[model samples]
Target: ASYPYKTTQQSCKARSSKVGAIKGYGNTLRGDEEGMRQALDTYGPLAAAIHTTTDLQFYGGSSSGHGAGIIDIPSCSKQVDHAIAIVGYGTENGKDYW
Candidate 1:
């Protein structure tokens, strides 16, 4: 079960060929929070990259008694290190979260 690592473009093409249609937003949403929000509202969900930090790495769920609140890691670095799905957005206790 070994396969060569495909470049991003190759992977995208393969997925499109198999799945039919695929849309790429590219870097158009960079620094565009409002745009991200609109896209989520219109298109359902989006794939996104995010900067990771220790707090985010160990975020336990509210059901685990860790506390039911939005995660806001203020000291997060600007370097993108992880991939995430921007499924939905909302405000929790007056703070925005996605």
Candidate 2:
């Protein structure tokens, strides 16, 4: 959650998992266009969910490996189609709401 994690590759991996929980998988979160919309669009639901769950929250694309900080979708990489939500730090942030 501090300096060390930021520089390491774990930063990106950690951030990725954070969002994944919030997105709600299987029948719990219910995957749909809305989930994608909440991610792609501004911080309407997706962002709020992250903030409410974690005090130190951020949203961004993994393509740049700058998760929460990356608001603008990087044009250079199209491989970051996967959306995720960072519930907490160190440990995975589980889903609280649907």
Candidate 3:
């Protein structure tokens, strides 16, 4: 898609151009945050699945200079549902987060 000339509501159209390719893929241990972090640090981004709910959708974290800490939503499920990529992780304000 052309960023400069693209339309917002353009009808979906078929294209014959190939953008990129996937070299390889694999899985990490279920419910393993450390393993996921290691995989991301060593092999680049990683895709993960988690549960999503109304509370999660509205979470914006604290803004009192504490910075956001590790987000552990115990209510989130282990089953595959929503998919998100783990590009990177680090600590903020002495809090380990992802």
TM-score of each: 0.65, 0.20, 0.61
> How many residue pairs in model 3 have overlapping backbones?
0
lDDT of 2 by residue, 49-78 (tens): 221222223432345544633142223432
* lDDT score for residue 95 of model 1: 96
Which one wins on TM-score?
1
Once all C-alphas are superposed, what RMSD does model 2 give against the true structure? 13.6
Report the lDDT tens digits of candidate 1 across residue range 1-98. 14533323453323224655666554444778898787778777788778877665545546653445787777745789888877888887799988
Among all windows of 10 consecutive residues in model 3, the one with the lowest summed lDDT is: 1-10
RMSD for each of the candidates: 8.1, 13.6, 6.4
The lDDT of each candidate is 0.68, 0.37, 0.68
How would you encode candidate 3's per-residue C-alpha lDDT over 1-98 as one tens digit per residue? 26432324676666679897899987887767888887888889887766776655545455632334456666756566678877888886786666
Off by over 4 Å in 3: 1-17, 60-72
